[model samples]
Target: MAESIPSDSPAVADDHHGHEEPSFWSKYVFSTDHKMIAMQYMFTGMAMAVIGGFMAYAFRMQLAFPGIEVPGFGIVTPANYNALVTNHGAIMIFWVAMPVLIAAFGNYLIPLMCGCDDMVFPKLNRLSYQIFLLSAVVLLSSFFVEGGGFGGAWTAYPPLSAKAEYSLTPLGSSIWLGAVALEFVAFLLGGINFITTAMNSRAPGMKLYDIPIVIWMIVIASILFLVSVGPLIAGAIMLLFDQQLGTAFFDPARGGDPVLWQHLFWFFGHPEVYVVLLPALGITAEIITVFARKKLFGYKTVLHTTIATGVLSFTVWAHHQFISGVDPRMAHVFTLTTLLISVPIAEMMFVYIATLYGGSIRLTTPMLWGLSFIAEFLIGGVTGIFLGASGADIYFHDTYFVLAHFHYTFFPIAIIGTFAGLTFWFPKMFGRMMNDRLGKIHFWGTIIPFNFIFIPLFVLGMGGQHRRIFDYSYFPELSMPWMQDIRVLATSSLLIMLGFQVVFFYNFIVSLRSGEKASKNPWKSNTLEWTADSPPPHGNWKELPTVYRGPYEYSVPGRDEDYWPQDQPN
Candidate 1:
């Protein structure tokens, strides 16, 4: 400032940077850098995952060995059991996996891949992370309060979530309402930043066609969030008012219909699955194309399928509420919408499988995760069709079968997809290759144990076991002995799944310092990020790249190399 250094000079950099590292508060606490914000989201999300996972482990201990004392955690009473179930679902689905997968990855990768200096509004991006953190803190804080966290389940269906008298603690329900509302606001701002940056901040000459599928999936998902989140936000406010101000928004006793909450919640909830799944699917698409040494088969088809799925997501909300006592006539329409939506999803999977055919496949860690996603998501999607059938749902609704179907879908999209993204982008994220041996071990450990955990849930569901019940002692007709056996296997599988993460964590942390140095284009794929520096600098590209090919132009018949970068000139 004394000499008025040029703004674009390397020494001068941007507005904030000068002779010294910005003050500790500006640098670490309120930083606007997308990368730092991403780290914030990642660490926060991981902490929440641990909390949520422990909750699941606690609940499973009870399920596997009923009346068992949970070591340092103490006994699992019924009220405590309900609290665990509700908070576990809320934290894992909303606060943990969703933020990590969508917000964290999306924030970190979108700017770098698109070749932008930073998000359009970097401060807003930072604010989003802070809001998410605040929401998590508020949510967790409720547990220590007088009434405990909300016990109405993640769905927060009325009469259950609405009335303080119905809940164990009078304030539990309101605390939950406040926490979810804050979380929604966090996502909304994050979504806005994503959409704005993607649409406006691409590197010079970078076209839509050249954009990575992962970014596309995120963009589409962001749009879905923007459109879908509003109704749920409105619903949450109404539910909160019903609890505090004695309004009848969702309170039947006060003239509000309890069923209204189900409609609003599922409206956002169903598409929310795709909102999480699309990014994972996009990761699968990117990893598969890079490792197969082949262009994505039917790239346009896959794009259309993603867009179609986003639109179709809004129409199928009622499928989740079929058993909530909605009108029977509307149920048929919902069932049709739910079952039919699977068509596009199935088509996308077909494209992935078709892409793998006759390709020179490199069985790297990312590819393993991609292949696992195909197998797991197929099982999840197909089983979802089973639940989509109104007839089957009438019997299976709220049963362990439904639980299994969702876990298959959820775990694959969440765990497998995240793993794929981590492996595929590890080089760029850390400037080094993850330990291949450790990675392979982690992959195998996750897939095998994951199957064991959820498949038994399906078996239990089909055997007529209901969900949310703390004890199965009374249900003697439901193959109690087999349920016991399944519970043991499931618990064992979960412990294994949880243990494998240690290997992943070790590999990730150690590799940052000791792993092999990654080449700029280690995977030999034709994406823009691969054309840039590994662990790209503050300003992504030294020179902005110009695009001339589709994202997956691998193994073209006459190409000199097996792959072509999207930015390479024809």
Candidate 2:
């Protein structure tokens, strides 16, 4: 059972012993180490999240109190409002969600959990972050450019996005497209790295079934992104050419169908939801199983369901096009596929619940987050059924209902899932336990206001309030006092949610500096990562672990301990 495992290279050994300590630049900034790179991606993504949140604040303030000078930001102009909405969507999805859920956690956890010292291609991993960083820089720089940022929205639908005259930001539009394209390329690289490393590198005896769910989820997500992103990248290039060169790929007057871009975008776009979502779901799975002190119910079922979800994701992209005048038969096909895709997701959620049943459940902050993900995301899933049906979507299309459904879904995937993962792994990542008291405070603060924020949007959407309206005063029907009152409620709820994030940040900083010192295996779980140091070193372990059992070996009969470590020999 104690077979020899691969050790770090001589160069790594020399750096630790024979050579001097690494400088700040080499150690933290441009390091080829996967963990450092993950830190870089995580922090960068967090910073972008703050920017995205501020954008939400700015735009929501405008919606709640039109023409009023917002604090921190003065009067929000029409262009400013559009840019805020557009970039907020783009940054949160691409910059924040993908980076944190996939790149950051994927990079950090894959190698460590897999019991390898580093990624298969460490330099390539570093290069991926560099490209991602450059893409972010390019995106932010667009806002300060000659025409301000692109206001064509995150989807960048054609006619508006393809034509400079319509978008009013020739340079900004092109730069935005370019930034998005570059970001895809970076992920393409990172995805390849994740897939290859997970496939190739594992400790001895760690069979396919023995691998952690988080690793599988990240790898599967990488595959989904790889398959789906190509068409959008091509469409982005074509859109760029239309904007800069004399092309009409998406211009109706020039014989190019604008809806063609919709096909290319949503084809990737719908699956993009699952791409981020799979990782978040995987994170919740880890948290739930650990805190509940139970074996994951139907682990293989979850795996198979995830794969089915990915396959079905491609078929459902056309649902977003139902209201775009797509062929009714095609819409019907997509509608069926859209509803079908939800089955696997719902199955995974049920599997989690089954795991929690009759188990010793701990109400830790991370567990609360994990449980809330299931609850909140269930709302998103159920609401999505309305949008999935072509007939219902025809009424709900482009309304605040769609917006509310989207937020309900994505808020869980990106924000709630992220917090769940962060809190669960805080000790492993930082070698210190986060303050549970503060964590619970922050959790309730965020969750309560969150429901308040979007539930009203669903109501407003049902009332036929258009999502894109800068101000509703012009429309007498929408300007009704009740409608405006709902808008204010949503916006005020957002402010409270944003305000509570302060508690999280304070808790994070204070805990990082001086928190309770944590020992290895703080969670006492079965995953291989727990066998290593609290904050594992350059070569994760003095000797790499050889797996002996599956990850979730809890409550095995005849043993005093309820939990079993994967590497422990009987």
Candidate 3:
């Protein structure tokens, strides 16, 4: 049904054909252009990633050396160590991962992939990023306030987080909570825009299955966030009241239940894993299919399994509470659910492998990252099985094993997945191709050292290294030379991994200014975004595209082209 547009059609007309040129401030700063807003979120997230990385470097130095003066951080006081670890966790998950994966990608890709010019509520999209920026500023400001930032860990459990005397950061604790609350609000607005636009703004004739996998994944993630965030917001409000208004919502001495916070926190926290994860999984799906030159192995199956994963995510939150005084019977139920949730996830992984099977594969940088995600996340998933067992969890909880497992999963999701999506899309976002040699160099530099870092921690975790202690040397059981050596190895590898990020930044800047110019379909991708101009114009298309087939129609028989774009008619 698709037809080539006539020259006079608005879809083919230049974006500025009839409109005034936007002022610099409106175009760059307060722009309602979804692409510009995406740029804002991307740059802000990159800045936060740098801050989070420094926090990791500072604390890891303290862990590996136990009192050596760390460069750029001075001596790591116990309080400073705690603050660094807490804020690092908070910033990476909240400011860096969520904003980059959801807000940045969702805003840029949703309308384009769904074959629309812009979001249904463009102003709401801009407001979302503004609020998110404010939230980041608020969180950073907390460190300079009285008593430094909150040190009760990222979870902010009660008694410690509720009572300022116990937490020793009366002002910081409240400010941290406020910052998180504001972030949730920003995403709430953004989520609505994502869902509404994808639902209502698709080009004519684009059906549900016609939607790209990434669009579906982003929408699912947004829905999951909207549904799961309510309880956490309520819990944060109560915690804030406890910190400032003398409320005892979590104070056991005041007839409050401290455990209530855990339930509320994990309820959101566990699903939040998938909230960020689904999009990464979606990113991999898109990349693997294009590079493999194959149709997705089973499109609907992947979709249904993703839904299954999201549903199962809610039931397994209590696995985290196995050692928190949960009843044995309750723990048994949660353990079953935790292990059960792995089925759909593992199925999804197998699906990716199957998609890659027997296809002509290109080992491009994005493909390498996509491939690495499947391999590394498998290790994270397998190790998580031991921790999911209630009996084993009793020994492993709060240990370095848990820490290593957490990073194996998160690093793949946040860092590797971001790189995959970014490199794959760079040509489209800017009218240029990234240096593949530099990209692969950064990839190997990051991946090899990454394993060295976490594998040592996994071993130390089995050797019973607790995660919370700032100085293991004081505890004779943990101070064994071998254990200390492993800590130093992990920290050293972390430095290597962090050092290679310089290659990525260098490549990014050089590519923007001087890389080879990109053709519209550089990767021969079939998605709607590819049909538009590279660095698509303000309105995206000279004329909007009309969908004629699904997004992954590679290698259709009797056609000279190996790929068929969504907007191309037979």
lDDT (Cα, tens digit) per residue for candidate 1, span 253-308? 66778888787888899889989999999999989888988778887899999999
Full-model lDDT for every candidate: 0.84, 0.90, 0.91
Off by over 4 Å in 3: 1-18
| lDDT string, candidate 2, 407-475, tens digits | 999999999999999998889889999999999999999999999999999999999888767888999
Candidate 3: the clashing residue pairs are 11-542, 11-543, 12-542, 12-543
- What TM-score would every model get versus the actual structure? 0.95, 0.96, 0.96
Show the lowest summed lDDT stretch of 10 residues, model 2.
Answer: 10-19
Candidate 1: residue pairs that collide: 401-461, 526-565
lDDT digits (tens) for residues 1-570 of candidate 3: 123544344223112322468889988998878899998999999999999999999999998998999999899998898899999999999998899999999999998898778776676778899999999999999999999998889999998999989999989999999999999999999999899889888987788999998889999999999999999999999999898899989999889999999999999999999989988899999999999998998999899999999899989999999889867789999889999989998998888999987788999999999999999999999999989999899999999899999899999989988999999999999999999999999999999999999999989889888887899878898899988888899899999999999999999999999999999989999999998889998888878888988888898889999999888888
- Please estimate how well model 1 matches the true structure, expressed as its whole-model Cα lDDT: 0.84
Better-scoring candidate (lDDT), 1 or 2: 2
lDDT of 3 at 284: 91
Candidate 2 has what TM-score? Answer: 0.96
Off by over 4 Å in 1: 1-25
Clashes of 2: 0
